[model samples]
Target: MIRAFRNEDSEAVVALWLEASLQAHAFVGKGYWESKVEDMRTLYLPLSEIVVDADEATGEITGFAALVEDFLAALFVAPRHQGKGTGTRLLKLAQKMRGTLELSVYAENERAVEFYRKHGFKVVGQGVEEATGHLELTMRFGG
Candidate 1:
């Protein structure tokens, strides 16, 4: 089930992060997972418009998605739970409320780039994020 993130779910959310981050960055160099975890925690913690997906049976956090105004900030699903429509559901939820949606995705993350494109976002700008040296692709949803 999808719901708001609660304090009780912090550790599970972290676990979801570690699991999904490892899978997503497996081809990257070593220590990438740790650095990403730290970066993500700091980036999303203070955001008020965040939603977490929980596995109804286990009550474990299976994924998470967040919206910062018109920007869809972060959407992640655990490796095991991916390809099961969770990400799409979250994306649709974000679209229902935001007219001019936007997001910054890592240039190297082709999976996410394709996903966003399939959902109608187009690359409108690009730059390197100084803090992480990650190439960022800025995408927009509105015409």
Candidate 2:
């Protein structure tokens, strides 16, 4: 089941974000993702709109998606939940909340790029993420 993120979920959400980020952006050193833990917890999550997909029985958070207005800031699914449709469900929930959305994905992360494409987002531009110097594509959803 999907629902708003609760304060008690802080650790799980950050852990999921770190794990997924490291897995999906393996081109970058693991330390790169680890370094963001503090900011992810103190800065990002508190400032964004986040939703989580939880196991109704165990109440374990399996996936989560976040947005800052129309910008898709973050979306991550625990490794165990990958390929389980949890990611797609979270993305669709975000779409329902924001009719049009924009997001950036690492150009080297093909899986994520394709996932966004399959969901009606098209690459509108490309640039480097200053923090990591990784090439990224900016995509936006139409209708």
Candidate 3:
């Protein structure tokens, strides 16, 4: 079940983000992701339009996608729930909500970059992310 994010879901969503980030972004130090938890909870999540995927039977959040304007600020799935189409479902919802979407992904995260490419997103630009000095690719879809 896909639905809008609620304030009460913050903890679960943040945890999911951390877990997914650690798994997908192994190049980034763990401390960096940990340090951003508060910001994700209070700043980024609040500033974006977020949608979560809840288990139909258990109602536990399995994945989520956050969009700020046309940019996909975040998309994460619980590790245990990944490879089960949860991420794809969340992305489809984001696309339906915003016809044209843009997102920045770390160039080193090949799995994620390929996922976006498989979903019809194209790398429109690339640059270094000043915060981490990591090469980041800007991808776009339907635009």
Q: TM-score for each prediction?
A: 0.85, 0.98, 0.98
lDDT per residue as tens, model 3, 10-99:
999999999999999989899999999999999999999999999989989999999999999999999999899999999998998999
- Give the runs in model 3 whose Cα sits over 4 Å from its true position: none
Query: Which stretches of candidate 1 lie above 4 Å from their native place?
Result: 27-32, 36-43
Taken over the whole model, the C-alpha lDDT of each candidate is: 0.80, 0.94, 0.95
Assess the local accuracy of residue 55 in candidate 2 as a C-alpha lDDT between 0 and 100. Answer: 99
Model 2 over residues 2-90: C-alpha lDDT tens digits?
99999999999999999888899999999988999999999999999999999999999999999999999999999889999999999
Clashes (candidate 3) = 0
Residue range with the least summed lDDT across 10 consecutive positions in model 2: 134-143
- 1 versus 2: better lDDT goes to: 2
Per-residue error for 54 in candidate 1, Å, reads 1.4
